[model samples]
Target: MSKLSIKPLADRVVVEPAAAEEKTAFGIIIPDTAKEKPQKGIIVAVGNGKKDEPLTVQVGDTVLYGKYSGTEIAIEGKDYLIMRESDIFAVL
Candidate 1:
């Protein structure tokens, strides 16, 4: 696939969320209704710093974020999250 054309502004960032697990370790198949939202993702795009506050995260960084932190979006049928750099909790 071609590179994403979306460009975040300010301290915003674009993240591609990790896929949710469909099965448990005990071999139990989890239904879609029981699946949890992934709190982790890879940075796909980053925005420039806001004034003197430069963003610490960069593209390709695997990060953990709050469950309800970012706004969900779809690009070419793929899911992504757009949120501020502060929304990300840590880089894994």
Candidate 2:
């Protein structure tokens, strides 16, 4: 992966979202209009925790989050999401 130029502040994290699924479990092709928003992503950047609390997730960690958790952004023509650490659920 290329180095990112953006940094998040205070407990916020920047994520690279997984691409939307293009096929169903049964091998059926899904149209773009029917593809659901991805709820999983990889942590690419992290912020220092507030004072005493340390961040549990780190760069390169794959995690799950709310379907609508973060704000979408484009960095160097690539898409990403920036959200608070709380929005992330579990590390996979």
- Provide the global lDDT of candidate 1 against the true structure: 0.82
What is the per-residue lDDT of model 1 for residues 16-87, given as tens digits with 9 covering 90 to 100? 987665653334342445545337778998999799998999898888787788899999899899999998
**C-alpha RMSD (angstroms) for model 2:** 4.8
For all predicted structures, in order, the TM-scores are: 0.78, 0.79
lDDT of 1 at 11: 97
> Over 4 Å off in model 1, which ranges?
22-38
Tell me the tens digit of each residue's lDDT in model 2 across 1-92: 57688879989999998776665343434344654533777899999988888899999997878778989999988999999999987887
Model 2, C-alpha of 13: deviation from truth (Å) = 0.2
The numbered model that scores best in TM-score is 2
The Cα RMSD of model 1 versus the native structure comes to 5.2
